[model samples]
Target: MSLCEIVRLEGYIQSSYLAVYPDKIMLLDGCCRADVPMVLDYIKTTLKRPVTDLKVVVVTHMHPDHAGGAHKFREETGCLIVSADKKKQWYSGIGGRTMHFVDIHLGYYVARRQGRPLKNLYYSASL
Candidate 1:
């Protein structure tokens, strides 16, 4: 069996894992929206692979630190998004939208605490 290399990428507010195989790549956790460029750069420049090689992105949860970059990745690379099958989005309705906003701010707070510059972490609540 072939082995895959797992690389940990430091995100804006958290870390994400990238599973690299010869033909494809999978990202564990979407990471913050601000981290999209960094992740893509790593795949293209560091890994020396085409961005389209990113085949899957698993969003473990609907938080800014976990699912923020999912849609952007899909849009940029045409990658598939994998997540829990749920009837409704985790962030739904007025209250859920409020919480989504709060969560993004919370991510910013964490970045500030880590001495990182604030970045745009806003993502659509529904995904």
Candidate 2:
């Protein structure tokens, strides 16, 4: 069985999950982009592992709160970002585009709070 930890983010009011395996860890949601440090701290202090030990980050949904920190996490940990293998049509339509735009804008705040600019974002869709 895998061990699960709830990564609590400040002000966001959403809980992210971290699954610990024998040799690696997996993140269920990226949480808020601004909360990257908190997530990393949990891994280091509680999980007692280097951030590099994280192997996968699964964005449960395209919502900003869910996938917001994915790109940053990937850059810091070299973990693979995973989403649904099938891109929902909603993800390519105007609504999806609008949401993505919002996410990008929100990332700016996160970057500022973290005192670092966010890198170019990318995601790998897979099962």
Candidate that would win on lDDT: 1
Model 2 per-residue lDDT tens digits across residues 16-97:
7777776788888776665677788878997789999888998877665677678888999999988767646335767767
For candidate 1, write residues 1-127 as lDDT tens digits: 2647999998888889999988999999888899999999999999999999999999989999899999999999999999999999998899998999899888888989999976899998988
Return the lDDT, model 1, position 119. Answer: 83
Clashing pairs in 1: none
lDDT of candidate model 2 versus the reference: 0.69
Model 1 / residue 29 / CA error / Å: 0.6
Residue 1's lDDT in candidate 2:
50
Root-mean-square deviation (CA) per prediction:
1.0, 5.5
Question: What TM-scores do the predictions have?
Answer: 0.96, 0.66
